[model samples]
Target: MIAIKGVSTITVAGLFAEVGDLSNYRDPRQIIKLAGLNLQMNQSGYFKGQTTITKRGRRRLRSLLYQVARPLSIHNEGFKELHHYYKNRANNPLTGKQSYVALSRKLIKIFFVIGTRNCSFDETRMLRDIPQLKPLQEVA
Candidate 1:
């Protein structure tokens, strides 16, 4: 896999080293769970509490992803746009930090695709596929 924007060589190596082989995982969601990035909902009967991460997997992996996400959202054009979209969406806008967390999860999925398929990252495809991320002019 090639180096993604804002992803350093060390970060990429660390990620690959942490993951080892991607064959065992059935899907990207599995990797997300492995990183403890899977959402956990605190809902019981009629009481629905906040949704948060499980935090039950590799702590170093989760921390590394978050560390990368913050800079990725600031330095990478695609990631930056996505981060802004996530934080400003109408339905349920996330805080800046929350958006970065979400981005970290997204990065996991991206890495999964890259590792499994041996394909390079496609920023334009990502931006295009998420229709909700279209500019305000188009939405309006």
Candidate 2:
């Protein structure tokens, strides 16, 4: 987790303390739901309510992730760019708070990947999906 910019040793410790062990989780979505960052909505065909985070799990984990997101948005290159994309995307743009929530969930996924794969964070891989945000290619 510390491999991710803006994440410190203490933050990693806190996350682990709250989440127990990452190996227990078979998928990142499990952690996302554990943090209560998974999306949920009320729908009955005739009426569809606004979608929002389930906010149903460990409160400390959710709070910790949310707190980490602000600095990640400012200091982490990949996270910063992703945050901008979330806010400025052409379809259903998110407000600032909503963007932060999304970033928090993303952070959980990053933590899970790094924990499982034992790999360092890669900024390029994080942004390659968005054509406009993808880094420019070098001239051969």
Candidate 3:
């Protein structure tokens, strides 16, 4: 976490404190849902309402992640690209706020991976899943 440009030691510590052990989570999405960063559909009957975050979990975790998101978007190259991709994608683009929420969720997933794997952060790994953002390799 500290290796990420925008994340400080205190922020990482706060995250661990709020989320407890990441191993308890079988999937990172569980932690995303726990932080209330997961999206929820607000629909009833035949009326299809807007989708929004549930905001149903630990408030501190949500706020902490959001707080971490601002700097990550500005200072972290991978996250900056992701935010741009989210906002500028041709299909169903997200607004700036939505992108931030997405970033926060991404951070949670990254934290989960690193915490469980006991490895350092890797920018290429972070963005590898997104087809549009694959890192280019040098030709021999």
Cα lDDT listed for each candidate = 0.85, 0.86, 0.88
Q: Model 3: per-residue lDDT, tens digit, 19-95?
A: 99888999999999888888889999999999999999999999999999988999998888899999999999999
What are the runs in model 2 whose C-alpha is more than 4 Å off? 135-140
What is the lDDT, from 0 to 100, of the residue 130 in candidate 3? Answer: 89
Error of 1 at 61 (Å): 0.4
| Per-residue lDDT value at 51 in model 1 | 89
Regions more than 4 Å wrong, model 1: 135-140
lDDT of 3 at 106: 90
Q: Which tens-of-lDDT digit does each residue in 4-80 have in candidate 1?
A: 87898889888877777888888988888888999989899999999888898999999999999999998888888
Instruction: Estimate the TM-score for candidate 1.
Output: 0.90
Please give the lDDT score for candidate 2: 0.86
Per-residue accuracy of model 2 over 5-119 as CA lDDT, tens digit each: 7999989999999998899999999999888989999788899999999889999999988899999999987788789889998998999989999888878888888999999
**Greater-lDDT candidate between 1 and 3:** 3
Candidate 1, poorest ten consecutive residues by summed lDDT: 131-140
Error of 2 at 123 (Å): 0.6
Q: Higher-TM-score candidate among 1 and 2? A: 2
